[model samples]
Target: MIENQIGKRFAEALSDSITDDDRVEEARDNLRQFCNAMEQDSQLGRFFLHPSIPEENKAALVMEFCEKISALEEVRNLMRMLVERQKMCFVKNVSAYFDEVVARRLNQARVQVVSAQPLSEDHIKKLKTMLDRVLGKSALLETRVDESLLGGLKLSVGSLVADASIKNALALLKQSIEKEEVLSEFASG
Candidate 1:
């Protein structure tokens, strides 16, 4: 929880610093690349999290990385600030929250749709339109096939999930029947 708060604060600050939409996206990409590098290289990750290491050395390495990636100046400064504050361990969290911030800023909602079979292009378009209308924001749909659903679709938008699948309906029906059986037994007893 604390990590999310810290990351959200940093992400909002970074997001506010950029005025151009393109730069915001570029910074996001740069941050993602930097975070990926840190995660993939254990030695580099250790170096950043080492408390005994001097901040200057870490800041210098950060600058080198930013230059290599051609990161925006704002992004570079943010990285330097993280190093100075010894908050480099939260880079991944910050990156994740940054994406959410960007999506919110762009008035876009990412929706994950799972269905029993592949949807046609027309069906996808209709679904996207309906989502946009209902959500009051543009919908970015990521669709996939989940045959276990049997039929119907399951949609996930952020923390909310809407399950209209045959499997889910059957499970609910089963639960209802079991509850009714227990109630009938109590009445008879």
Candidate 2:
């Protein structure tokens, strides 16, 4: 497992170095995209994390990669530090935590919603507005369809899940009926 402190410190360093919101967001995007690439391509991750490759070569490769991605100086420095410490395998974890830091700075939450069917654009917009107001933060919604949902929506934001699906409602009703029947039986006996 990657150490959370390492990612936290790297994100803090990057956050401290950039003051402009646009530039900060750009840096975050650059890191996020590159880390996503690393995650999606195992060969890329292996190449970077391989012990046979010398640290200097790794540094050069990382610099070139960062330049290609137009990463800011702070991001480049963090990548170099990761290379030096031989922590390339933890790039995804670092990027994820870094994104959290950026999102927190922007007062936003990334929400995922699953429904029985695809929602209309207007419905999506209304849901976003409601979530934004209810969360007290800007909501970035990602939607998906699940046929098993029956109807309604399931929203996940951070650790909270709000399930309003007919499936869930039926399950609750069944449980309530079972509990009431048990209570009546106990009283009668």
Candidate 3:
């Protein structure tokens, strides 16, 4: 919860810094790229979070990288703030929060859909429509095929999850059967 609050603070501060809509979009991309890079590269993530590395050095490294990428000053400031506060490990969370804030500002919902097989455009559209009705916002769906789902699909919107997969259904059925067997054994005893 504290980590979430820290991330939200940074995301809100960054959001407040942007004056133009285009800059907000650009900062979103910049932050996503920066956070993904840190997450994908353990060494890079460590360099920022490592205890031995001075905070100033970490800030300098981030500033240089941001300058090279021509990132918005707001993004650079956010990176520096995270480094100084020893919260570099929360970069991904910050990005997620920032994206949520931007999406809220735009009245759009970003959702992820996982299914046993790739869905057709029409199917995705229908799913989006369902999500729109549920979330009361325009839904933007990101689809992925996960064979492990066995059948059907799962939808994740922010913190909410809607699981309709056969695997989940079977698991629930098994739990119910187990409970019934236990109850019968207790009665017999």
Best by TM-score: 2
Cα deviation of 38, candidate 2, in Å: 1.5
Q: Between candidates 1 and 2, which one is better according to TM-score?
A: 2
Q: Clashing pairs in model 3?
A: none
Cα lDDT of candidate 2 equals: 0.88
lDDT of 2 by residue, 16-74 (tens): 88888888889888888887788787888889978998899989988998889888888
Q: List the global CA lDDT of all models.
A: 0.95, 0.88, 0.88
Q: In model 1, how many backbone clashes occur? A: 0
Clashes of each: 0, 0, 0
Provide the global lDDT of candidate 3 against the true structure: 0.88
**RMSD in Å for candidate 1, one decimal?**
2.8
lDDT of 3 by residue, 44-154 (tens): 987886798888888888998898789998898888878877888888888989998889877888899999999998998888888899889989898999998899999
**How high is each candidate's TM-score?**
0.80, 0.89, 0.77
Regions more than 4 Å wrong, model 1:
115-123, 142-151, 187-189
Ranking by TM-score: 2, 1, 3
Top lDDT prediction, candidate number: 1
Which pairs, if any, clash in model 1? none
Residue 26 in model 1: lDDT: 96
In the order shown, what is each candidate's alpha-carbon RMSD? 2.8, 1.9, 3.1
